[model samples]
Target: MTARVLVAGIGNVFLADDGFGVEVVRRLAGVELPAWAKVADYGVRGLHLAYDLAAADYELTVLVDATARGDEAGTVHVIELDTGRTEQTPCLDAHGMQPDVVLNLLAWLGEAPRRVVLVGCEPEVLDHRMGLSPSVERAVGTAAGAVVDLVTNHGR
Candidate 1:
């Protein structure tokens, strides 16, 4: 059976704190998840992610990434995107890992998951570093838990 949910961890690991999603997914590897769910680390592979979404009929696609919303670092936010609204014409960049761009590309391909959620963390450092800042590091577990909850509960 095809998976009903797709949990994608996207970001650039070379950039500090931007690797939050990658770290979270790595942690998720140790947790138990529903069989109908597929988890993957699609770091900076926006084109690949867009293709996957278009090829599958997943009901929900959860994107975990580092997002800056002017809040304190390490803060995690769960955002639900309105897939029906296409306010801006997204520009396609093969290397771009931004969630919106991937989703827009899915739409452009005439396919999209029924729902999209972004589990994001406020990044402390997006510099050329290999690891996350202290605060962002601490939030990795929380974000992983959030992803599990969202998928297990089917986004309830």
Candidate 2:
């Protein structure tokens, strides 16, 4: 069967560069996509995202977000996550936005997808402000393109 893919943009747009994911997905929505690829803006709802992952049956799920990776700002990264080995954790906040927490929760709920990937950018700042810095903003187009490539190549 052809893999079904979900491209999710995750972050809090109110926080400076942390809004990278949201912006990327917003841009991606304007692009043409394959029938098997789906895009969603999860913003800061980790638990809701977790449940959505659990409820849906997708073969590949790509998570796009701003990560605190120790790198130069606006740097884009693609990472493949190993699933099916999630550990049990305590209560979960349905509105949480951390990708790791949401993935762990999905594993806990026995809803981990077959394959997962993370496409993220290094944030220059994360403050209680709206809009992205120049560097991070520039990376959004690159990230969105990268995600489209991923979906087109992997989901078909």
Candidate 3:
């Protein structure tokens, strides 16, 4: 059966705090989630994510990534995306997976979830590295819990 919600973990593992999403989802693997919710690690594969979104008719899509919103590093922000806004042109790059680009590609494909949300953490360092910074690593569990809350309490 198709999942009602898609939890997509996206980022580059080699780029320090950019791996926040990937780590958060990894933590989620240990937690119990609803059967209708699906979690995936789509690290740096924006095109793959877009195609998956286009092919499936999900009620909601949650994208987890490291976001720089000018706040303190390791700050987790849950922002709801306005799927109705599709003014930007779609661009696809296999190596670079920007959330906006994936959303634009989904829009271009004429398929979108009913609601879209981003679970983003403020990145400390995006430099080439194998692991997340201390701050970002600390926020991984918080972000994972937030994702769990979102999926379980949706529409309640």
Model 1 stretches with alpha carbons more than 4 Å out: 85-89
On residues 102-121, what C-alpha lDDT tens digit does candidate 1 reach at each position? 87777776676799999999
lDDT of 2 at 64: 93
Error of 2 at 20 (Å): 0.6
TM-score of each: 0.94, 0.93, 0.96
Scored by CA lDDT, what does every candidate get? Answer: 0.90, 0.87, 0.90
Cand. 2 Cα-lDDT: 0.87
lDDT of 2 at 90: 33
Residue-by-residue lDDT tens digits, candidate 2, 56-118: 888889999998779999999999987765666836766558877887887777676888899
Give me the displacement of residue 125 in model 1, in angstroms. 0.2
Clash counts for the predictions, in order: 0, 1, 0
The lDDT, on a scale of 0 to 1, for candidate 3 is: 0.90
Q: How far is candidate 1 from the true structure (C-alpha RMSD, Å)?
A: 1.5
Candidate 1: count the clashes.
0
